[model samples]
Target: MEPTSSAPGQLQSVTRALSVLGCFRNGEDLGVSEIARRLDLPVSTTHRLLAALVEAGFLDKVDVSSRYRLGTALAEYGQIAYRQHRIHLAEPHLEELAAITGAKASVATRHGNDAVLLGTSSWREADGHELQGLRLPLHASALGKVLLAWAQAGEGELARLPYDSGTARSISGPAELGAELARTRERGYAFNDEELVSGFRTIGVPIGDEPGQVRFALGLRGPVELMIDERVPFFVDLAKVTARKIADVLR
Candidate 1:
């Protein structure tokens, strides 16, 4: 078992397939042509990859359209991962928090330059807002800010962020984000005042006891009117309590 001649080819195929799935990070149903363009691969090669994924139940083709969307297999795997990470244990707490605060309550972890939602509960109607599995920009999301602040990330790491993305109200540069992180640390929470989405605000707090050892963050999000400045302190207090409860269970 010294080596296999086809190992490199198999590795390349696996990488390509993962890249294709990563292209759907925004939860969009994509056509073969669009996926190929994004990956800079030829149409024939992309089509083959799509066919394999469809056969494996990782993706499903729309009946009336050529677009492809995530399949049931991915959902099954997502649930398995959720339970493995003990995120499912926080679902009930998040739901209670959402009900009490009348906003979206979620737990997230830093994934590279983004914050990936692990669990979420919304008080409002299901208006096509799927917070779980969604990636929020670090500089533009309260959860991201809390994670970055508690982690005490270095300047080089901050400089590599996508500062130009997100809403116009987002932090424009690393220096600005550094100042914001300092404020977040001082306040013991992070605030996203329409930095990620227009007309919505979020408050975030660390879940763990130690400062730089924080591994997760809890967030409460709602519309600007509902999450008014006058109510922010109240919301932050409740969120901190809920985060502590969740952390206790995780430990």
Candidate 2:
């Protein structure tokens, strides 16, 4: 098969470089032979691609070794990526939640199959940062469940997917998950208590009037004690109120 170029300038070079970079996802520190074999390109082509990517700061080659790893250009790209218009707009809402809850509040959306944080008011911002870009699981988080339930379309969409979990407390299988999603749709929110990571919990509501179709999320995060304790129902109500406010602003 031939690689398609979107335009003429440096397309082939870019394609080859991307292919080499993709080799890192399932494994680490690949040398020329592995990259060439995985990408099915000639070793010479792979070497040239690696050289170009390394020069462009997209890949790094450690001294005294022939292996390659991701480089600074990707980090720069990530920084650039987190500064989109939507992320900027969502900050005020995240800030409101953070101020009220005195914890981390953020906005997220489906980035492919993963939930990507778009904006945040985390506890660490006084040290000179905000939660700009972080990917979280959609299958194992309160935010993730909200995203998925919304994606389910509220019309028997619940029954179609497999809903197994990575943790013990999670719904055991897809059938049960479909039923759980049915409930989530009824309540207009979702919760995760130590589901993704032990001792971490969250309550997330969709950013739009509708669920899965919403482009953003409002999330509250803290220790499990705070989320699962008596204050949780109140916090969920707070999150829902805040979500309605966000939807009104966007509407």
**What are the per-residue Cα lDDT tens digits for candidate 2 across 1-251?**
66656466577777777777767754378898888898888999888888988999988997778889988998798678766443655568778877877657777777655677766774643212322226665656777677877776443444443445446776555566667667777888887777766666778888775533777777888776556678877888888887877676555
| RMSD, one per candidate, in order | 2.0, 5.7
Residue pairs in collision within model 2: 150-212, 163-174
Look at candidate 1 and tell me the lDDT of residue 46: 96
Q: Which prediction has the highest lDDT against the true structure?
A: 1
Tens-digit lDDT string for candidate 1 (6-81): 8999999999999999998888999999999999999999999999999999999997898999988999999999
C-alpha-based local distance difference test score of model 2: 0.71
Query: What's the TM for model 2?
Result: 0.69
Worst 10-residue lDDT window for candidate 2 reads 124-133
* Model 2 regions more than 4 Å off: 1-49, 60-72, 75-81, 124-133, 153-165, 245-251
After best superposition, candidate 1 residue 138: deviation in angstroms? 0.5
